[model samples]
Target: MANTTSAKKATRKIARRTEVNKSRRSRVRGFIRKVEEAIASGDQALAQAALKAAQPELMRAATKGVLHANTASRKVSRLASRVKSLSA
Candidate 1:
């Protein structure tokens, strides 16, 4: 129960932010899934392309505070490595 006017306003703001964050998180996940699917399909070219596309999205999520910077970097690194291995 938000008794004060300010508290009520903050609650509304939080709800709005939560929705936005959820969308961003989902989008990031979708990008990662695309890369993984490409990798799983054993298409090096598609996996490379997917990883290329996902890198920016992951970084954007990190910059926007949806994910930690290192976390995003780690994901990109791991995915890139896996994609690269498909070349060998």
Candidate 2:
């Protein structure tokens, strides 16, 4: 499908970028899932720690354009609130 040399190069670049982005997305989700699993296990301390670790990963994904900044912030806020409420 990529007839021109430039187009073929572009396609290759896209494939590489797609793989990188997919890895990044999966890593971010793994961090979030750790927080969720900690929360589900009802370990307040563990949940807090997982959320702490996830915050930066979420923000990093946002900065890399994998997620919107607002979405990352909202997720951090919600997770923090839930972690906090676990103490109550």
lDDT of 2 at 59: 98
Error of 2 at 66 (Å): 0.9
* Predicted candidate 1 versus true structure: per-residue lDDT over 24-73, tens digit per residue: 99999999999999999999999999999999999999999999999999
Off by over 4 Å in 1: none
lDDT of each: 0.97, 0.94
Model 2 misplaced stretches (Cα beyond 4 Å): none
What's the true lDDT of residue 4 in model 1?
A: 98
TM-score of 1: 0.98
TM-score of each: 0.98, 0.95
| Reference-based lDDT, residue 50, model 2 | 98
